[model samples]
Target: MTTNTILFDLDGTLLEMQTEPFVKSYLVEVGRHIGDKYDTEKLLKLIWDATKAMIVNQDADKTNEQVFIEYFTANSEWEREEVWPLFDSFYRDVFPTLSHLTYPSPWAKKIVETAKAQGYRVAVATNPVFPREAIFHRLAWIGMSADDFELVTVYEESHFTKPNPGYFAEICQKLGVQPTECIMIGNHMQEDMVASTLGMKTYLVTNWMEDRGEPQYPVDQRGSLEELYQALTERTGVFAQA
Candidate 1:
């Protein structure tokens, strides 16, 4: 089937940032932001535990944000009422400032625009562990905007996280596209390539590649973001032939 949609992963794929350093910085900044009012270490632990909840989440009724907050409510000193404003403030004022951790991709904008110009539905298919502001700020770092895509997953609405087939399934369901109608593009060998299991075509971006023994899916194409740009704009390779 001809693919009509494209899903791009953020972070290492589009935004140029190593996953480990970026996440460590994020965890530290968030801890320092709200931890002054509470037990800092405990709060950090709570946040991670909540994050893990979102990753393994299976309940369709509960959004990842709800699951994260629920972990805090049930196991921590803070209440939902208290957590929202604190995290919201951090995401708005602090998260955007972390763009220094990620540099812009020279080809990110071109690939996205080429797909859009070709009338393909594009999604910033980043993991939905973070809030909308977090995702938007990261997109801004890569010289794109959340509004540029047909769908941008956020913790407030998403019920699954990366490497889980359910996450891709949820996105497919939301976009009204069959898995065979889309291409999943990213740098991570496992998390991004897992979309292939759902029958979505996979394109593995090599810059800042994360390979942790997830060679299960036979990648349909593999190269740099610039190569992806070529595939779309030049209308060649698996993308054009799909």
Candidate 2:
């Protein structure tokens, strides 16, 4: 089937960064933002727990934000009205400073432009564990924005998270396309390549490839973002506009 849509993962794929250090930096900054109001360890634990709840959430009625907030507020002493704004402030004011830990791929823009030029829809299928503001800020690090994609998944907007076939299905449904008509591009074999289980073509971008032995699904292609740019340009027969 002709591919009509391309889904790209944000972290480690187009935006280069070591996951562990980046996450630690993020948590530390958030801890600094919270200060003595909450214990850093306890707060981080709650965040992780809420994130896990969002990932496994099967409730189609509730968005991921609702799921996360419901779980987070319930487990913590803070009420939603008082604590939610603090989290938003952290993303808006503090998250941008972490850009030093991530470098953009030279071919990132070209890849998206190529897909658009070839009449394919583009979506950023980043794991929806972050608020839209945080996701947008990360995109800005690469000189891209939410407007660049047909769909950008965020916790507030998504009901399912990555590595879950339902997440891909939700995107396909939103795009009015079949799973086979889409391609998933990312650095993780288990997370991105798992889209193949639903018939989506999978490309493993090895820029920061995770060392997951023996992928559960077939990888249609594998390469660095630059090579991906070249391959996609060739496949789409669409050169970057001068």
Which number leads on lDDT? 1
Task: Encode model 2's per-residue lDDT on 4-105: one tens digit a residue.
Answer: 888999999878877778998898888889999878789889998998999899988889999998999889987778777888888878998899988776
What C-alpha lDDT values do all the predictions have?
0.88, 0.86
Lowest lDDT sum, 10 consecutive residues, model 1, at 233-242
Give candidates' CA RMSD values in order: 1.4, 3.0
Error of 2 at 94 (Å): 0.3
Q: TM-scores of the models, in the given order? A: 0.95, 0.94
Largest TM-score belongs to which candidate?
A: 1
Off by over 4 Å in 2: 236-242
Candidate 1: segments with Cα more than 4 A from true spot: none
